[model samples]
Target: MEPMRRTVWGMLAALFLATAVTVTGCSVTTEDPSYIPPAPLPPLEQLEKAPLADPKNFSSGGDVLSFITADRTISCSLTSARGEHVNLPYEQNGYSDAANNKLPIVPVAHCGLVTYQPPQPGDVKDDCAGTHLGYLGGVALLAPDTARYGECRSGVTPMEAAYGPGGTKAGPLTQLTVLADGQNLERNGLRCSAYNGGVACGNVSAGVGFFISPERYELVPAPAISSASPQAEGPKTP
Candidate 1:
């Protein structure tokens, strides 16, 4: 009887030990309380396409005038004076609903260049490089002549290239004035400003700025197409 009792006790101990190990294994495999997944980044596929603007959108002086914003976030499309379709990509933010108390849609136009300041203080020249379009002295201008556009150290997304490390910030421009001679204009509820060298227009609320050089890019007040006169009745004979 004593041997039988000893054997039974040994078996009970083994079962208890196995049960404890099983519970311990489950505790170790439980999910972590403090683990958090990182936020996903934006996929900038638009950067892969060829750049849209060349020398301030209106480099060639023409009868029809139109301007294109370099901002990547705002969609810009209009028929050129030559009847060519022009479109630029843009990003929109915020909400329009008043009940939600959300902010209105603020559109920030993304330029196509990376602007860098000089390493030393008081350097007259800035190392503006990254893309064809660059910001200099509070103005965004063409930089391929002054600096190589694709030589920047950063990756070439419109946002990363324009405002990445060592890049310069855009100028503070408020109010929009119409560039047409003596006539002010508004488009899509935004104002515009016209100057001798270029027409500058920006919406502070939307965080957008558009600059067209030589004032010829103005699209409004375009020349009307004349009606075709009726063909002579005698021309239809075979």
Candidate 2:
């Protein structure tokens, strides 16, 4: 009886030990790995707001005169591509109050520009552009406004010359705009010879240049851009 009792006790002890081992060795299976959540991102703040984002829509600054005379140009602050903060976006407009060459502020005949209309396709020519604006003055040419004998010669003009921010190699723009008014300043269209002759009529003037937006604009630093140039990765991989 004593031996049987010892055997039974031993069997119970062995069973308890096995159960404990099994529980300790067991692992839980889960679709997700043991997780530690990432820290949250910072909130975004408003950067910039410009009412004149569109030029054609023309809430403001549609033309040089209107832009220059305007009492104030509004803009907003913003973050840049490279993590810089800007106070005013309109600064991108590059509106300068600097005195221009003092040409009569006659309503810009055509706010748009004129390029030497290249000669015909088959025409022999070394230059893709017509005679330079400089030479146009000396050449006798019918006036677009008057059809009268050559009065104003055109080609490369003063606007093409350098001043202020210097100038682009391209010729200076003339009349940088076209106005509805002709010989006179009026809301109505002009009565230039072209208008009467049933031909296309546009005004011409000189000293036009492109304007940068005054709105807050961001630019990537040159170094980062240079580093990421096309050759940055070497030859293309198949």
Candidate 3:
């Protein structure tokens, strides 16, 4: 009877140990090893608000208002489609289609660089077959609203030749006003801002814009807006 009693106590001890191990295993948890965090947002999206550009930094002419960066690296001009001069160059340049007999003069914001490197052959899509690819002329934000990075010129223009070391001197940007850093100018539904890094310009309502610097260029698309908020309207000429 004494041996049987000892055997029963040993069996009880074994049951208790098994239960403790099961409970401990249930409490242990392991994190997912394959999980990855999302990338951060671009710096431009983080800007709280954009202030109106200083009036002194821009000059308003017949149908265009032009401004230059403080460093004189970039120059931009805003043209209104409704302005009288819009038809002059389009007609003289013979952009008018013979069938329509009229060319659409779009409200546009265009920028030119005093100096920049030409993108590698495959870097950007080149529409210009015979013409020299122009990079220093920079980018343009059209009111019909698309951002274009390079231009095709008939020949190597002054700005195109001005790329290599100690290149040709840039001429006066048509005596344009200076748009200093941290300031922005808006006209005919287009806006351009200057920063320490580079210049960003685009059609505000459409959310289409571009960023240009001596080193690189990027086309920025409009961010998604919540349905609860009002939709931004398209460009309207004043």
Q: Pick the candidate with the highest TM-score.
A: 3
Q: Write the per-residue lDDT of candidate 1 for residues 79-128, one digit (tens) a residue.
A: 11111111122212122224434333222221222332212222224344
Task: Judging by lDDT, tell me the better candidate of 2 and 3.
Answer: 3
Regarding TM-score, does 1 or 3 come out ahead?
A: 3
lDDT of each: 0.30, 0.23, 0.60
TM-score of each: 0.20, 0.17, 0.56
lDDT of 2 at 3: 100
Candidate 3, superposed: residue stretches over 4 Å from native? 1-48, 54-57, 80-101, 120-126, 129-137, 154-174, 222-238
Q: 134-191, model 3: which lDDT tens digit per residue?
A: 4324544445456666656554433333433465544445356777777777776677
Clashes of each: 12, 28, 0
Name the runs in model 1 displaced over 4 angstroms: 1-104, 107-184, 187-189, 202-238
List residue ranges in candidate 2 displaced over 4 A: 1-114, 118-155, 162-186, 191-238
What RMSD does each model have against the real structure? 20.2, 26.5, 17.0
Query: Which structure is stronger by lDDT: 1 or 3?
Result: 3
**On a 0 to 100 scale, what is the lDDT of residue 144 in model 1?**
11
